[model samples]
Target: MPLSSPVPRALRHTRAIEVEAFARDDGLWDLDARITDVKVRDVTLASGVRTGGTYLHNLHLRITINRELTIVDAEAASDAVPYPGYCDTIAPAYKKLIGLSLMKGFRLGVKERLSGVLGCTHLSELAQILPTAAIQAYANDVIQTRDGAGHDPLPDKPFQIDKCHALRAEGPAVAVYYPRWVAKAVPG
Candidate 1:
């Protein structure tokens, strides 16, 4: 359902985030995330004055992970920033993400390694989307979500079964779409 119309309001600032996932030929996956911030009105910053429609911040973050969802390579770039030299210098710090697992404690690990002055706020925020993005990219290709009829030998439950409201183990949606897993999900 779409949201109800709201009171008329003027546009001021806009922030756009885009994430793309790619399956590499070497049997790995790459998730690239970018963030852009633009102001509809002129803004003054310590670096200089940013004209309307110009980018105040443009950042990119990419992480390459193996089938196990463990990050093997990570990189970040700051193309446009409010504070040029200082803000761009922190891009290299994102390499700390290597070796972290997207399915396990990834958010907390990001905070511990890149919070506060350790990393740029925009780029760090972009990293948070990678986990879910990777999961969506690997839905059927890498991880068998069992969305279709199959008697595959994988024994573990579907990764998304209890992850959200609609896919809750005991929810009606599950009863109709994933009936086989329903019995195993209910309390004994």
Candidate 2:
């Protein structure tokens, strides 16, 4: 974890609607920002990765501003990240196992969509839309779902963003998350 810094007490509060307003008023409805510090967490059952019958992977992408973007450092909260269910352990060697091409595609697509939707011409414009909640919601659909039947995993639904944060500084930080599925069956 980085140094424990505190987030600003308050700034302009903007919900999805207000964010939309900012984007529209600023003519920045097609901007996507880069996602950094991306970490992948795997949720396994007691049966283990190959025998568990189901595995869930959550990709959390964290980024800090490198340009004229505002960043509000919020006190890191333990409960902020929610898990639908308990996870046995975070997998190791996931990157080597998942491959780079797929990772690049996923990250690139996310950045493109974000930049396109926000239309952030400058880093500041992108900063306003930082601290974006609902990123998890958006990821729900990006993750692949595996059924342990040797069939390919596919997206089950549309992605939605669950959380958003905004910081006004020369550079701002943001995080986006998505889920992926892995599964296998053990012979009883």
Candidate 3:
């Protein structure tokens, strides 16, 4: 199971931290209040661990962060669950949201959307989609990169937010593997 943070429960300050952090980058914001709930999915091929084309096994990272990070009103965001059939079906359609060259743009768009809402002082809370901007931006970038770059592999630069609300921005922080092929054999 993924582990929740040591930050205890949500409070005004904690919520603020959560809001500010998530309000910047959707991926770093684990709105679910518990990191443990965040799962990274992988794609595998031919029963091999290291060989084959891979998709980020965890397609639900965006969804989970969106669902969990909406702390302004837990009740309102409670219903934001992963699509029932998403995992089973996403593989065929899965594509990287951010490629190597455009990661800065991809992340910047996320921050723009998140921060954009904060300008609304009258609104004490931010919406789920506000954080989703990152995901959407990445998706858009991925489509363009794939089409324009001719199948060049892009590096995944995953990031995370901490209790202090500081962002740990660095190289591909999270590694998710997707197997291009799978075996019918079930483990006994």
In order, what lDDT does every prediction score? Answer: 0.90, 0.26, 0.27
For every model in order, what is the number of clashing pairs? 0, 41, 20
RMSD of 3: 22.0
Error of 2 at 130 (Å): 4.8
RMSD of each: 2.0, 23.7, 22.0
lDDT of 3 by residue, 64-165 (tens): 233232222221122111333432332211122222112234334334433443222111123323344434433433222231123444443222221112
Arranged by lDDT, best first: 1, 3, 2
lDDT of 2 by residue, 97-117 (tens): 121222124344325433442
Q: After superposition, how far is residue 119 of candidate 3 from its true place, in Å?
A: 13
Candidate 2 regions with alpha-carbon error over 4 angstroms: 1-55, 70-188
Write down the worst ten-residue block by lDDT for model 2.
Answer: 72-81
Number of the top candidate by TM-score?
1
List the candidate 1 regions with Cα displacement exceeding 4 Å.
147-154, 184-188
* Model 3 poorest 10 in a row by lDDT: 173-182
Give the lowest summed-lDDT range of ten residues in model 1: 146-155
lDDT of 1 by residue, 1-188 (tens): 99999899999999999999999999998899999999999999978899999999899999999999999999999999998878989988999999999999999999999999999888888998889899999998998887535556347778889989999987888777777777555465
1 or 2, greater by TM-score: 1
